[model samples]
Target: MDKTPSSPTAVEVLTNLVADDLKAVNLAIVERMQSPVALIPQLAGHLIAAGGKRLRPMLTLASAQLLNYQGDKHIGLAACVEFIHTATLLHDDVVDESDLRRGQDSANAIWGNKPSVLVGDFLFSRSFELMVQADSLKVMEILSHASSVIAQGEVLQLITANDADTTQEAYLEVIQAKTAQLFAAACHVGGLVAGSTPEEEEALQAYGNNLGIAFQLIDDALDYSAKQAELGKAVGDDFRDGKMTLPVILAVARGDDEEKAFWKRTQEDQEFRDGDLEHALSLLNKHNTLDDTVSRARDYGNQAISVLDIFPDSPAKEALKGIVTFCIERAY
Candidate 1:
């Protein structure tokens, strides 16, 4: 924001810039998550209290400031964005039968799958409630459409999950919808509430969409590249889950017949063995898939930064740009 050579991390910078407003968003989240039914709030609070970067809400808040928005609506809307994200995560853990979230036991693991899923439902409903309370049909439309797209993305990912033949185009579609749409909506809603021009709003959406893509790409690659502590989960969690992320896809494409057979056995047939993860890493490095996947993330990160050219210089604008860097640099 200050054009300094040395700056704190992007989230750190944005956290400070929007500190007061983020506090309000947190308060709103706490208030809305409350329910007379004890388990509803308990399970919901578990995940909310679990450490997350809160990046999506930050995007909403940052985008609002980009347009010099003076209103407080973005705070509530930002919480709505987080609720939608948390709801999806809750449902996703149930679907994936995940054991851990944020390096801790998943809600589904602590509570039964049914409670987890039902609480996710509660959160989703609460998100709509917040959107409606904002009193903007356009905001509701955008978030509702994003919710649909995210659900569709989940379905698409499920269909493509174990199949190695899934194309890059199909995978991108999944990430764009599953991960990026909410990000786009979060940023777009900020601009919309601030009454930014359509062009400016679209730019904010583009920046957020690209940032989300980069974020997901890095996450997928990190499943292979990072350590348990650093990644906040097992290194081969995706591999163990038989999830067909980009690195595996690329490795499968470039691999020889034996490698292909291995991927088919492990990923498709789920016939995983002890050294499977090591073999998978070997193949990924041999094909440079990890580096290439990260390169792809960098491409998207660069696009995200480029679109910020539309916004005039401000601390929020610079912090938004820094977020792109933070996302891409995660691989390193």
Candidate 2:
């Protein structure tokens, strides 16, 4: 978890390897985002252009390429995955009332909530349209299940939002649904599209599921450790928003009666005071919870790497493996 960063990042290498294919995906994205009403594309493109890593779609491409997929169905499928992801972000920002996304004003912050939600729906319908066009029931099944699970994950998170009693297992479940499910679906569809054996498909799904969980664990840690510039959002956004991520949950579990009262006051009650964040950090450090959380992430990272053993050697395979290290290194 504390390893030095790689010289040439996995993202750089992966993007370079898939440059041509990614261009196709990008073209598909731009083409599909069009609307009779200008604002649909305007609003959707704003977030799409925001310079995030586009990690899920990359996984889709890399996984398919590893299996040596020859057709262009994956490109359109990758675009559909991006649409689902972007739509979720739009709805999430509205729900979270977030101001900044990837260091820019959130769509809801600029365009108003109604448009944000509606545009999200538009993107969702567009994703479904693409799903239908792909003409593979397997692909449709995976993405549609992922779509449903993502919504379920959001609801589960809402259920646990401010409850201090939320267990580590429960938190993992929430992330799996809201975040990892898509990652898993994206990779799984790649294998399916390549006509991989069911076991290989399952292995890819496992790789993605574990990677997605580790990815989110880092985000939970970053909410405290990363500076605003590094994270592209204000620190303590989770705390101020009363989200009970792992660090807070760890501190809550290990905190003394007084510390528990402090967390309860700020988190459960949403009554954050000036030094509350500092105190939260102190509690997290005192319990070594932050590093411990990353430690769990590392364990999952190892799982993601080991699952790739089933695949024969290829550049795409190697890059997918690099992704595990890159994900952990990013947390550092």
Candidate 3:
């Protein structure tokens, strides 16, 4: 929050600011995930312990801090945000037939799909329980609607999967629903619990929505990035899964007939020969689609930062701005 040129990343700054609150959230998560059924806890713990950035929950907590919310309700709500995200990840691994998550064996890969999906459901139920405990119908409405929209987004992505002709508009719709909706709700509820003015809450929601879009855009670009491969994360997972992300969409749009045929055979048909991924990367580079995708992400990141202007300058505001920077700078 202190704008020192040599400060740690925004995420670190925010994490340190919210360290105590985050501890409470983590405790709540561990306590809530417990189940007498061994596998439920076991499988859920596996993913929870995998140590993601916890960014979504962090947004909820930070938004509460920004508004000077005095109550502890944000703690439980932040945990709820995480539960929803973790649930989606579990289901997504199963649906994507993913072997890895966060550079480790996916829950489904280790435990099988049925347990993974069921445990995801368990977490979803727990999330709603937490929401109910918050005792705010507005909060429940926002989060429950986000849950529904996320499911719909997954289905929409499934429909678009393996189809090379997927338009940018459809792709935006998918990310906005699946990713941004929760972000908007997370920030919105934070402001709501603080009794923020409608205008302030709207600003928070808009900020979060744009940040989520930029976050996902960078993630999509990273799937084909050399830096991602170097970081030991799986590159080309999207390509192997035949997922049509922005870079691929742009490449397909710009490609010649032979190139389109190549995409159809690989992405649409799911046929693979050696060097196919490399060739796909080549096409992306040739079209500069990767750079273009990053550019697009930056655009959204800027919008996120701009929306925060409604809030008075404070450490919270500065940290929120840093989050936007962190989201976009990941591409480099």
Candidate number with greatest lDDT: 3
Over 1-332, each residue of candidate 1 has an lDDT whose tens digit, in order, gives 67757757877998998899999999999999999999998999999999898899999999999999999999999999999999999999999998999988999999989999999999999999999988999999999999999999999999988887878988999999999999999999999999989899889889889989999999999999755556568788888888888999999999889999999999888898889899899999999999999999999999999998988899999999998998888888
Total residue pair clashes for candidate 1 = 0
Q: Write the per-residue lDDT of candidate 3 for residues 38-131, one digit (tens) a residue.
A: 9988899899999788899989999999998888999999999999999999999999998888878999999999999999999999999999
Cα distance off (Å), candidate 1, residue 233? 0.2
Name the regions of candidate 2 deviating beyond 4 angstroms: 1-6
Per-model lDDT: 0.92, 0.91, 0.93
TM-score (all chains, Cα) for each model: 0.97, 0.97, 0.97
RMSD of 2: 3.1
Candidates 2 and 3 compared by lDDT, better number:
3
lDDT by residue for model 2 over 261-332, one digit each (tens)? 998888788887788888888899999998999999999999999999989999999899888888887767
- Which prediction has more favorable lDDT, 1 or 3? 3
All models, RMSD in angstroms: 2.8, 3.1, 2.7
Worst 10 residues of 3 by lDDT: 225-234
> Can you tell me which runs of candidate 3 are displaced by over 4 Å?
1-6, 230-232
